[model samples]
Target: MSALHFSRVVIVGVGLIGGSLALSLKRAGVVGTVVGVGRSAASLEKAKSLGVIDEIASLEDAARGASLIVLCAPVAQNFALLHALEPHLEPGTIVTDAGSTKSDVIMAAKTALGDKVAQFVPAHPIAGRELSGVEAALNDLYLGKKVVLCPLQENARTDVAAVRAMWESTGADCHVMSAVQHDAVFAAVSHLPHLLAFALVAQLVNAEDAALKLDFAGGGFRDFTRIAGSSPEMWRDICIANKEALLREIDTYEKVLAHLKTQIKEGDAEGLERVFTRASGARQKWGTARAAVTNVEP
Candidate 1:
């Protein structure tokens, strides 16, 4: 189906992801009437004022007639949203999400939605920054980014394709994967990195001479810990939800850190050089690829 076919787009949770999706869909002319639904009246008002949606809708009302319902809320609230909207959702309506984690979400949909699970397509757009809320939303947030869709075995191909088309309308490339694989890969690349950043920043903040150290922090320090500034509540839910995979990743990281410490303590310059060189080269390659795809001038 063409992206333009989705006439009524309902976005739950008018935060950064939801608000941005609403705006982008309208801009692309993929949606006729965009509806914002959330518990926060203030935020819903903000989204409406910003023209993020054509109207503000109650959760039940939003799902009643929506052709596409996008859950852009925190992973913790997904189950509740599903339960509340399941009874109201029209048959053949497509439901998708922008939640970071997917396994629990898929499980929730299965349990709460039953047969409606076939109409649901689980997706995570691998984009966004530390900042959040509708105020921080950018129209081009998903431009040239990768969006992973975790489709269950029972999901209809037409529904999955429709979800893909919606995301592609905003210039995102969609990739398909199983929910388990998605959780495992993100646990290492996304979740683990956030944990490390939070830990590193927390250690420094709790130090006896924190003020002195903070005063001397440079660009590297700022860059390394930038993600530590993300919403604690959101990250907390993610850590708990993906505990098993995250814990394994953490253990592996600890071993690597131990090896690096041994090399440093022993004054093994060769060992340090080899490790740093490989890490630096890999980062450089990744940066080049990102720059090329995003058309970043620098």
Candidate 2:
């Protein structure tokens, strides 16, 4: 639709992100053929059956002459995939990813592809749901969503433009950032929050009155823990992949949490109110800005 197109695009995971991307490209009429590849043959077959992909191919066969190859698998699986792709990669092929953690995957791409690493552009689509798999994938999942691209110094401008155009075709607005910056930012805002949500849910589940506590949980609890319903395997990889940045965030959070504990133990009403007021104000401001941008409500 935007005069940008890909002849043969390979999706390495064929799950939520990958399947939705394939569907979006098909809907936009920007792709000639979408090939699905993954660890599970059943998943690939399911994606093909759902019309999310035009065909199913092995990772080895999908790399040759591919216009674009998007690695949408769990972050931990990327290195081996890239290593496998290196031998079959064509000069015309441009590789990218929808990985949540970039720095680690960039490192993997560099290690796996060596001098050809420039062909790989690291990207993260700031969109998804608690639901996963091809069945949960939607054509409009990336509409009005944000995508961050971290390009390497050796990357060609044309290759970068192709990746940008691909995401824009799906109605995603793309922004550029350095790999280190991308990792640190997501570690604070994304990874830490997911970690907290999982921790809270795990705590409740381990409690003596787990069922009672869960039954009594209200809207606030549900809202806060919603991300806990995300794929455990995916988050596990993201957490470890970006652990250095996440650990720093965790240490900082612990200090803030300790201070709050002190205030509560001393019955410092003013202190508590000040913190609450600041947090509420910031959250409301962010929500308002986000609503204006996305035009979607909670």
Candidate 3:
């Protein structure tokens, strides 16, 4: 199969990720046809009205003809969708996903797809905002972003390469990692941060002094907790799915917090300054790394 030619690309659950993918595929001219699959007739209609897909298809029907199948649903729904569509998937079809946590999805694919597990490539695109649904999608969402593929030991090399090529065609830099490592890294950087934001905001709102808290919420508070506004359902699922890693991250964060508290209690100005300086330097370095990854030179 030509790297540039995808005969039929099917996107399951045409929400933000799926819709954005369809738009990107169209922009890249990589697929001849894009089919969107969703249970909600309204969402399917909205996706079509927004030009996210060339056509809408039932899950089974879409699986029958797709050259590539992209699962863009919530992590919790992936297994059920996999089982339902497994029997219908055409042989040699390349199946991939945009779920946040990968291990469970990979396991589900293996169980449901069985011999066809070699055709599946579990992927996570490290780009999203605190929004949901087809309306939140933009064609440029994946451009210059990192898309990580967690290829299984048994996955076909050609299938993995094809998946990498598809994401690269959209101007995304692709990397390969094991499912366990992917989940561990994301649990710290992605899942734990989201959980913290949600917890912080929820704590404030539940306080009797909520109005006073809001009045004092300036740029720092807003910026720090921006991810708190993301869909609760999605974050809830992510936290539960990656609980072990997230718990470890939470423990690490608590230790840092304890150090800060101890310094404050002892009135150790030098200690506090040193801590702040180290944090600021680390944040600056991270910012530079992020800019390097997302910035493309013309």
Models 1 onward score TM values of 0.95, 0.98, 0.94
Per-residue lDDT of model 1, residues 56-103, tens digit only? 878888777789999988889889999988889899689999988989
Q: Model 2 segments beyond 4 Å from truth?
A: none
Local error of candidate 3 at 245, Å? 1.2
lDDT of 2 by residue, 46-70 (tens): 9988999988888888887799999
By TM-score rank, best first, the candidates go 2, 1, 3
RMSD of 2: 0.9
Residue-wise C-alpha lDDT for candidate 3, range 116-214, written one tens digit per residue: 888888999988888899999999899988999998888888888888889988788998888899999999889988988998998999999999989
1 or 2, greater by TM-score: 2
Candidate 3, pairs of clashing residues: none
Error of 1 at 122 (Å): 0.4
Which residue runs of candidate 3 sit more than 4 Å off their true CA positions?
A: 1-3, 296-298
Selected candidate, larger TM-score, 1 vs 3: 1
lDDT of 2: 0.94
lDDT score for residue 239 of model 3: 83
List residue ranges in candidate 1 displaced over 4 A: 1-3
List per-candidate RMSD values in Å.
Answer: 1.7, 0.9, 2.2
Q: What is the lDDT of residue 137 in candidate 2?
A: 97
Query: Over the full model, what C-alpha lDDT does candidate 3 score relative to the true structure?
Result: 0.88
